[model samples]
Every structure is written in C-alpha cells, then in structure tokens.
Target: MSSDTKGALLDVVKGGVVSVTLFAAFLNLPVIGLPAAALTPFPALYFGLKRGNRAGIGLVLLAAVLVALAGGPEASVLYLGQSALLALALGWGVARGYSASRSIATAVLVTLGLAAAAAAVYSVASGVDLHERVVAGIRESISQALSLYEKRGIKGDELKPFRDALEQGGEVLSRLYPALLLIGQSIVAGINVMLLRRFANRLPAPIRIAPFNSFRNPDYLVWVAIAVGFSLLIDNNVVNAAALNVATVAGFLYFLQGLAIVRHYFETYSVPALLRYLFYAMLVMQAYLAIAVALLGLFDLWADFRRPRKPKNL
Candidate 1:
C-alpha cells in the first residue's frame, strides 16, 4: 500500500480506539459516564470532517465491532443507534457546509427515523409492542425507586402519597418518552456540533460556523406551537398525549432561541464569564428560570429584543 493509504488506515484505527475508549468510560464510570457517552461520537465526527467520509465510517464501524466483541450484540446496536448514526448524520451535514440548525435538524430527523425503524424491527422480531415494553420498563423502574424510598423509612401515609406521585410521574414519562428522546438526541447533536466548531481550527480545513447567539427558528414554528397549545384543550387522552409531545418539542426549541437571545445580550454587554456561568448554573438548577427563558424566546417574536433600537431624537 502507498504511504498515504497506510496513514489513513492508521488514523482510522486511532480514531476507532478513541471512540471505543469513550464508550467504555460511559459504560463503566458513574457520574461522568454520561458526559463521556455524549462525546463518543466526537472522534468519528471529527475524523470524518477532517479526513473524509470513509475515515469517519471506518472509525464508527471499527468502534461498533469492538463494542460488540466486548459488550455483546445488543450493546453494539445501542452504540450504533445512540452514537454512531448520529455522528454520521452530523458529519455529513457539517462537511457539506450546512448551517448549524440545519445540520442538527437533519441529525435529529435521521436518528429519529432510525430509532423508529429499529423499534419496529425489534417489535416484529420479538413479537412484542415496543411502546408497551417501554411503559412496562418505566413502571418497573418506578417500583424499584419506590422500594428504595420505602426501605429508607417514611412509611404509611407518606409512602402512599409518594408511591402515587411516582406512579403518576412514571406514566407521564412513559407517554413523553418519544419527545424526550428527540430533545435528548438534539442535545447530543448540538453538543458535538459545538465541540466540532470549537476545535475545527485544528483540522487542515477550517469550516465557518455562525455565532450561536444569532440562532432563530423559522417564524412558522410559532403557528405550530399555537396549534399545539389549542389542541391541548381537547379532552381526549390520545389527543392530549400527542399534543403534549409536540408542545414539549416546541417548548425546547423556543428555549434554545431564548438562550441565543441571552447569549447575544451577554456578548453585547461584554458580560463577565463568571456571571454568565452562574446564570447558566441557575438555569439548570431552577426549572422556573428555564420556563421564563423559553417565554422570553417566544415573546421575542414581537419584542425583537435582539434588534438594535434606533437612537431616540434629542
């Protein structure tokens, strides 16, 4: 083989090793495991963007094989669905010079499609409904949590209310799992994209990435959000569930818009880094603040908070 071919192959192997190592950390580590898993796609995405599609695909395939050998077929499937495929989608978009939002949307749609197809195949092969299975698993987890709480004392009436609340929450979560999955994968894609942008300069060819503060969803989305809001008034459980899912997704999009607005102001004012970090920390710890931010984003449609106001006549 030529030296160039040898170098490409070696790089692929190195990237694959990094991917698997991150996946392993995600599986084995406790608190930091999730963050590690979130980054499992980075190596493939980076290599693909830097070296080309084949290198990225090689990294992903090699990593999948390593995962399957170490963790079994199911784990390999999980890695592909959760990490590899997303990397491929994001890498494809970024390499083609797609906008950040467009790239993330493409990644989300592709991953969601793959997830639905995988669920259908699993249901068919196993002769079980995937939705029902997910609900059952959720309930099982709730039961385990309740048992743990009970073992820690607080019995009788306290326990009864807690159990009831847990059951209700689990049911809601089961219903919202699909929406949650979308939001989650979107987050994963966004993070990897941001990371790629941040480090893109290190690559041979640096790509242009628009400032995050400038992000804005299409205006038509507001109408859809309004429609979902109206649909929530319907009494039917099925309708309510579906509407809730759509609203949840819409809310998340608005929340991101709101964050972009916040970032814009922060940059305009040259906000201190420590204050910005604290504000972000508060957003994570205070749910109401997040909702408020989403509202801010929504109202920005009319308010145009990001737009510069013309100087008032003296």
Candidate 2:
C-alpha cells in the first residue's frame, strides 16, 4: 500500500482505539461517568477535522461496532446516537471554520435534538411515560435510603420529615426534569468544546477557537425569555410547562453570557488572576449571586456594559 494510505489507516486505528477507551470509561466509571462519556466524541471529532468527513464517519462506525460487540446493542446505540453524533457536529463545525459561539451553539442544539429523538423513540417503543419512570426511580431510591435509615434505628419523627421532604423533592424533580436535562446536556457539550479547544492546535488539522470568555448570545433571545416569563401567568399546564423549559434554558444561556461579560471587565481592568478565580468560586457557591449574574447578563443587552467609549479628539 502507498505511504499516504498506510498513514490514513493508522489514523483510523488510533481513532477507533481512543473511542473504545473513552466509551468504556464512560460506562464503567461512577461519579465521573458523565465527563468520561462526554469525551467519547473527541476522537472522532479530531479525526474528522484532520481527515475528511467520510473517513471520520467511518471511524465512528468502527467505534460503534466495537462498543456493540463489547458492551452490547444498548451501549452501541447510546454511544452512536448521543456521543458519536455530537462529535460529528463538533468536527463539522470546526472543519467549516465556524466561530466559537456558533460551533458551541450547533453542538448544543445537536445534543438536544438527538436526546429528544432518543427519548421519543424509547417512549413510543415502551409505551411508558418517561417522566413518570424517572420520578418513580427517584422515589424508589429515596424509599430505599429511608428504609436503611430506619433499620439503623433512626425511625420515628426524625425520619418522617426527611421522608416527606424526599418525596416532595422527587415531585419537583419530575416536574422540572425536562429543563434539567436540557441544561445538563448543553453543559456537557459546552464543556467538551472548551476542552477540545486546548488540543485543537496539536491535532493533524489545526483549528483555532475563540476563548469562551468572549462568548455572547444574540440580544433577540431576551424577547423570547420575556415571552416565556409572561407565559408563567397562564393557568394551562401545557403552556406553563413549555414556558418553564424555555425559560430555564434561556436563563442558563444568559448566565453564561454574564460570565463572559465579567471576564471581559476583569481582563480590561487588569484584575488579578487569583481574584478572578475567587469571583467564579463565589458564583458557583452562591445561588443568589448566580441569579444576579443572569439578570446582569439579560440587562446587558440594553445596558451595553462591554461597549468601549469612543476616544474624544483633544
């Protein structure tokens, strides 16, 4: 075989190996499992950007087959449908030289679309309410925990309050799960893109992504957020639920934009690196502060906090 052909084949092999390792880590790891799963697409993304799309897709198929053989049909489908497809979108975005914001948005949308499709398919096939199943699983877990606590001699009033709280929590979780899921999957895709940026220059095909600190969402999104907020006043369960989901997603997106604005000011003012780290820590630990940041982000659309003042002629 020609030297070029041999090198291409080796790349394919390498991509397959990386995919399998990451997928295995995703399946086997416990607390860190989601992060491990998020990395499953990186191999295919790298190869797709480096080689042609066709070759990259071929590598993904090979990886999926390997996963199916080793982990079973369910594993193969999950890896292919979720992680593999995400990687493909990321690779396609980078290869086409999309901006960092656009690329990340594309990846997040792809994740949401694939996730919705999978859930719909599963719901139809099983004839079960997915939300109810999830809530039931949560309740079961709470029940098991409470039982263990009871067995350990912590019954009576102490357990009663906790049990009530846990049940109530489960109900809230079921109601808000759709929003939670969207935020979670978006975060996963966003983080993966951030991580991938660090290695982009070292890959076979170098791609430069703008720093996340400079990211911004369009201003028109604010109107959608306002509409969703108004919908909350309506009494219809369907409208309220739909509004809740949209509002939650918009809130998180604006929070990110707010963060970027903070980063910009810190950079512009030459703020100390340590202080910037502390700022982020405070935002994460304080729920109210995070909400405040989101408000700042939304208001920034009109406030124009980041706009530079024009220099006056002397």
Candidate 3:
C-alpha cells in the first residue's frame, strides 16, 4: 500500500479506537446521565483537536444527543446549546491563533452564555411560565419548610423569623433565574475543565500532573478533610446526604489528583508494564468515582443552591 494510504488508514483506526474506548468507559458509570450531560463539552474538544470545529459540529451534535437523553427533556435544550458553544469556542481558538489564556477565557464566557440561553429556552418551552412556576415552586417549598418548623414546635416568634426569611427567598427564586443560570454555568465550566485536561489536552501546555505541591497545601487539605469528615459524621438523612455532598466535591478533587498521577508518571520516566496496568486501573476507578461524586453534587446543587462558599485566601 502507498505510504499515504497506510497513514490515513492508521489514523482512522486510531480515531475509532479512541471513540469506542471513551464511550464504553463512560457508559460503565452509574451517573452516566449527568456526567455525560456535563461531558457535553468533551466531544467538541475532541473534534477540535482531531479535525477542528467546522468538521466537529457533527461530533458535538452526537454528544449533545447522548447528554440530552440522560438529562431529560427539560434540560435537553441547555445541554445541546452548551455543546454547540463548546464547539464554537474550541474552533474559534484554533482559527484565531488564540493564546491559551485567551482560549480559556473565551470558553468560560461562551459557557456562561450558552448556559443562560439554555435556561431561558427551557423556561419558555416548558408549559408553565418561568416566573409563575418558580414562584409557585418556591411557595410550595416554603410551606413544606414551615410545616416542618411547626412540627419542631419552635417558639412562635422564632417561627416568624424563619417564615419571613423563606417568604423572601421565594421571591428571589422567582426573579433570579439569571443567577441560577450563572451557577449552573459555573458548574458546567468546572466539569469542562476536568474533561479537557483529563482527555482532550485543551488546557495550557505544560499540562499539570501529580506530586503536585498544591496537594500539600495545608489549608486546602485541612478544609477538604474537614468537609469530608463532617459529611461522614452527618450521614443520617437529608442532612447525612451532605456526606455524599462532601464526597462529590472531594471526589472530583481526587479525580484530578489521580489524573495528575498518571500524567506525572508518564512524564517522569518510562512506563513500566505494572505501572501501565495500574494506570489503566486507576482511570477506570476514577471514572466511576467521578460519576458518583458528580451525581452527588447534582443533588446537592438542586436541593440547596448555596453550599457554604468561602473566600479563597490567595
């Protein structure tokens, strides 16, 4: 065979191999639906890496379908729109000769826009008007909260303050749909960064790896350990779920650490047979864990819009 023909055939085979491998690996996870939804950004990145954005439109569409099917009809629009933005951002970067920081900034902005657009589209398309429905849902939620408060038999005056607060919150949920979209966009962005770094090589060069000095950063470790440790202690009911809540956040961090380990090992020296097996094993394990934590995070975000946020001490 001609060298050109041989090389083209090899490339095709490799692409197919990678696609099947990634899809299968992802499918094995329990939270395939949500992670797959969050993963809407990945196929675009893959396509951009392999064939650029114009050619990647079809691939991104396919991932959108996979993601949408899992998130349900309500979120299908948002997922597909985000996927489209991801493709555009990646393609635009390649075409414009964007610096790494510029590409990242573009991706972040596009992700926010796409997420907000998706929310607006979904809100309008769903049978109920967003303003009315959000108000209703918030009221129903507040009533339930008050009923529980009553059962606790709190002093009547104490109940008044709590009830007043929820009444105010109900109004907020009704009008602050934009803020909610922003929160979702932030979440989707984090997932994209994770996927891009772990699989698509979309991050700035000198890709980070493990034995990371950041790992030993005392504050980070201490706070995370405390979060996870506290969650474990509280794992009783709705409150206990915060443990899994802690798990999702903590697990994603570990997932990144594990990915770095694999990268570092490869960068540091030759890949031994045993290490290769170990690396593959870790990848599979982390994929499952990432899925679980992502699902946990999903519920956490859904039930409580604000998880305790802290100002980062730079």
Candidate 4:
C-alpha cells in the first residue's frame, strides 16, 4: 500500500482514539462505553485529510446522525449541519493545500468562515434560537463556577469577582456560539496533526513561506497599521491598553512566523541557508511597510481629489 494510504488509515484510527477518549472521559467508558453518538463529521476531519470529498461527506452524515441523537434531533441536526459544512470547507482548503498551521491570516479566515457560516445558518433556520442555546451553555459554565465558589464554605466579596468574570465571559460567548466551534476545531486539528505525526507518521507539514510574507499583503499592513495607530491615538486608558495589546500580538505573531520559517530551514537544511531565508523573509514581510504608510498618509488627497463622477441614471 502507498504510504499515503497508510497515513489515511492512521488518521481514522487516530481520530477515533481521540474522540473515544473524549467520550470515555466524560461519559464513563467502562460503564456506558463510547457513545456512538459522536461518530460523525467531526471525525470526517481525519477522513478528509486522508481521503477525499466523498469520504468526507459520508463521515459528515454519520456524525450528524450521532450528534442529532445525543443533542436531541433538532439541536443535533443544527450543530451537525454546521459541523459538516465546517469540515467540508476545511477539507476543501486542505485539499487545495491551504495552510492549516496557525498564522494571523489563517486565524482570521478560519474565524470569519465559521462565524459567518453559523450566523447565516442561524438566521435562516426557524426556531434554532441561537441566543437561547448560547445562554444555556453559559448558564451551565457559570453554574459550575458558582458550585466551585460555594464549595469553599466561604462567603465574601471575593466570590463577586469570580461571578462577574464568568458572567462577562458568558456575555461574549452568547454572541459567539460559533467561536466555540472554531476554537474546538483549531484545538482538535492541532492535536490530530501532532498525533498523526507522533504515532502514525502520517503528519503533513505546512507549506513553507517566508515569515514576513504576511506583511507583504498591502491590505494586511493597512489594517494592522490602522489597528496599531488607533491604539496609540485612543484616549481611554483601557482602550489604549487593548490597542497596545493588539499591536504587540500582531508584531509578535508576524515576527514569530518568520522565526518559525527560519528555524524550519535550519533544521531541514544548513545554517547558512536558514539565515539567508530568514533575511529574505524579513525583507518580504517589510516590503510593503513603507508603501502602506505612504498610502495612508495620502488619504486626504484620495478623499478630496475624487475622480470625476460619471453621470448616473442616464
């Protein structure tokens, strides 16, 4: 058999192990055994990487059925449908060889895709009541926190912060039910990649790019600059702090991506090549910095000097 086939099979076994382990931890493996309830599209994630669309779609259907059974037909259907779509989209990207590794652009795309799809589906589906489902999850988490706080046999102002923090988190989650899926998918994908590599030797490497390549995208630089400049210009101390945090993270992630690329080269090739690659990548990333800033500076000219408007509704 081809190594790829072996890798694919390993993917299935690895995914099953991961899912079953989760089920066992939560539902008691020795007693109820692994819930066939979760055996659907989420697992298709593994299948998709190894196989193709047909296998992926089939897995989705299976997982959807299981999810429906566990979550109640309606909730399960809604969630599985989302999961199926997410898997398909992710699978397609994988098939097309999009980077599955973490990077800001990838992070943004994944977040937007999941959020946009869920928002659209929820908007269309009657009685799905996303807000309510969200509230329920938050309530459960808050309940857990409250349980912990109460167990201390202590009552004081300290408990207030814990409740307040949880409530704030719940508020954020209420609007971002999709975030739960995205976060879980990212986590699962990372774990799956690691396991496949460690055990099955089926791991695929992310396509190497110059770390600074992200900086070359003019749009990216513009938005990042806006983000940073706005942070520096903001009046409120809290907002300023938040802006600084954003700036710091973006700078760090972009730089870190370059470092990662350089390190990869060093490990796979020679030290000289690694240094050269790092230098080039750094140059590539910074290539647009000057131009982006120049364009931003020319904003007034762009606004005040609009092109002649052609007659409309002629």
Across 33-109, the per-residue lDDT of candidate 1 in tens digits comes to 88988899999999888778998898899999999999999889889998999999998888788999999999989
Q: What is the C-alpha lDDT of each candidate?
A: 0.91, 0.83, 0.53, 0.52
lDDT of 2 by residue, 1-314 (tens): 99877877788889998889988987898777767777778778877777778878989999999999999999998888778888888877877888867776787688778778889998999998987788789889888989998999888988998889888887767678888877776676777678778877777766768887777789789889989989999999999988888888899989988888898889899999999899889998999999999988888888888888899999
Off by over 4 Å in 1: none
What candidate 4 gets wrong by more than 4 Å, as runs, is 1-42, 78-83, 102-117, 120-144, 157-185, 194-314
Q: Judged by lDDT against the true structure, how good is candidate 3?
A: 0.53
Query: In candidate 4, what are the lDDT values of residues 67-175, reduced to their tens digit?
Result: 4566557654454443455456655655555544533235336645766777769667865766576689789989887888889864578788888888898876665
Candidate 1 positional error at 51, Å: 0.9
Model 3 stretches with alpha carbons more than 4 Å out: 1-37, 65-75, 82-84, 99-101, 108-129, 144-165, 171-176, 198-314
TM-score of 1: 0.95
Looking at model 1, the pairs that clash are none
Tell me the tens digit of each residue's lDDT in model 3 across 116-226: 566689777885576566678779989999999899997588899998898887765555544454445545654554455565354333333222312211226436656
Leading candidate by TM-score: 1
State every prediction's TM-score relative to the real structure.
0.95, 0.89, 0.41, 0.48
Q: Which stretches of candidate 2 lie above 4 Å from their native place?
A: 148-153, 203-208, 310-314
